[model samples]
Target chain A: MEDSLVLVDIGNTNIHIWEEGKIYDIKNPIAFGEDVFYISVNENKEKEFLKLNPSALNLKNVVNFDTSYIGLGIDRIMACKAVDDGLVVDAGSAVTIDIMQNKVHLGGVIMPGISSIKKAYATISPKLDIEFGELNLKKLPQNTQEAVTFGGIGAVVLMINSLKKDKKVYLTGGDGKFLSRYIDGVYVKDLVFRGMLKTIKEDLREGKK
Target chain B: MEDSLVLVDIGNTNIHIWEEGKIYDIKNPIAFGEDVFYISVNENKEKEFLKLNPSALNLKNVVNFDTSYIGLGIDRIMACKAVDDGLVVDAGSAVTIDIMQNKVHLGGVIMPGISSIKKAYATISPKLDIEFGELNLKKLPQNTQEAVTFGGIGAVVLMINSLKKDKKVYLTGGDGKFLSRYIDGVYVKDLVFRGMLKTIKEDLREGKK
Candidate 1:
């Protein structure tokens, strides 16, 4: 029964669905049965999905975690919930770095993702409209491409390193694998799904669902 | 005679003119007499200014610097020229951090300016359309505003601090004063102009101009 269960995450840009060890990213909500559970940061997409299947459970209703961050996105909360300790980095449209210690959400910072940083550079000037290349943070950049790339990727890498002191790091989101090359971290693509599943299991054990 | 000379910097967004002890920011190029030396990153604006005063000295022709970095901006070069030993940070449309020691240019990195970072956040998601507030780098941000602010400002600060070691930092550009409050540096508004003047003085002494 657990293998058949569908988990959905509605984000700003896409709707991600996971089922039976397979993941799918869709622009629109798919037809799911009553056994589906979902989390959404996009309100309009949530409403659209709910219209298709009103019985689908919203994970936000079932999951609970200790966090002091007010107005934090549910997506971020779910990512943090999966980690009992260490740093959680979700690098997609926006990069969120959350710290979890002893099952408690310490706090996190948000940065523009790789593509967003690229777009920001292009917006600043036509000369900066180039793709970011490999950067060695040990040495300063000597050329424009390296300079911009260092600024975009190096900033994130340096910030994570600054905060990571002796803690394991979990990487997720679209750019996670790419960032993993620069940062010493484990790439967990299904981290959010893991958090949702863990929450459901806890909820079931307590006879709450 | 030095007091009557005008120094203009044509940037992507505005034309900055430094005359005597006063600086002026204008959208359009102003009519200046022959006693004008200017550096420009905007080709269109440079053409417009040259149309009015053909004999006006282009600082790029007179200024010389020792550097291996190719395709480096003239404005950045000018900023670096003013300093013999230190980090030169020109935080305008783009935050350029260049390292110089013993009158030799080492290298640098470029990060988006504060406003560009804000725009990048907004472009990622409308929910992130908020002003960056003062950040405490010691602690992880808890809220969205703080998170975004910390990411924007904290990243630059951390990068600068990491590279600083024992080097003195010089801050210039539009947001130089604001950044000075965070980074231990002196804000010099006329840094680029000073570089240009120094170059012209050297050229005159060598009978090259």
Candidate 2:
């Protein structure tokens, strides 16, 4: 596993690393390791990665789903490709849901991830002094503190319930557990990485021919 | 009716006018007329309205809901106050739902409205060219065109459905017509105005005392 290629999914929020099938969060101290399969929407970070690991395969250029829309986002496409069918819900800085059936990636929705929503209101209205706390969507929110938490998380829970209607929905991301709690979904970590590994295996098979 | 006060609800997307019990959309040329009651979250716009008519009352500063949390938008509280026991879904640049029962304001959820989602993606990825045409929530979106359009509207539809479980929901705002098609809600054209009128009437009653 030490010598294995690191699958990196550079997202709007964080740099997600998949090492030996496990997901690791890496930020600030960017690591340039051995063989790397990299994909990112942020151009500046991608350039920095390229400079550090010249041999790193820019997976963004390599993987394109037949069903993915133009500018659908490389990170999202990779997550969609990981699954054979049904919905792939990636909960990064923003949550993206792409429906893939029989390898064809159908389109999905994008909404602000939980923390992003919280960060938004707090940033705009600093006078409120909304600090972090637990939330219960079942009970009526009493004050501004409860309202912000519920507003951010409740909207997303409702979104997941809407799309996951009577279908097997897969959840992956930092806040996947938080979202999955409200809805019935299978949480699979390192989905983008898993998709990258599949891509590498396919490329190797094609190269041998 | 000529001497009736003009109600202006300056929102994130549009400036809504309620005059003679009708709603008017004013886009380009800003209108100024006799006796205006204005409510807006935007401070600059509030200042401009104040300059236009020094006598105009900005309800954002004056009206405070007994049940609403601090920093809750006046537009939303006003909308909630319009309904006695139901859900108020104000569909503007952002969709906010406030729960009101027995004149007690329960908390609500806020998310990006239909057009905001569309504009956001188009702004981030200009090359996509997501010009609106038609949307079918039942059908799987074929390409980026369908994805962006459907994604924007569909998510909000689902959100409405989630919040509307067993409870009556009312739809308002610029995109209310678009959202109404997918959900079961009574479309109230000028909710902010309706609420504003209610607020002004209450104030006048209190002032008489």
What candidate 2 gets wrong by more than 4 Å, as runs, is A1-74, A84-86, A100-107, A114-135, A140-145, A166-168, A177-183, A201-203, A206-209, B1-73, B101-104, B113-133, B166-168, B196-209
Please give, for residues A140-205, the per-residue lDDT of candidate 1 as tens digits. Answer: 798999999889999999989988988899999999999999999999999999898888887644
lDDT of 2 at B23: 76
DockQ of 2: 0.28
- What RMSD value applies to candidate 1? 1.5
Supply DockQ values for each candidate: 0.86, 0.28
In order, the TM-score of chain B in each prediction is 0.95, 0.80
In model 1 chain B, where is the ten-residue run with the lowest total lDDT? Answer: B200-209
- Flag regions of model 1 displaced more than 4 Å: A207-209
Question: Residue-pair clashes per candidate, as listed?
Answer: 0, 0
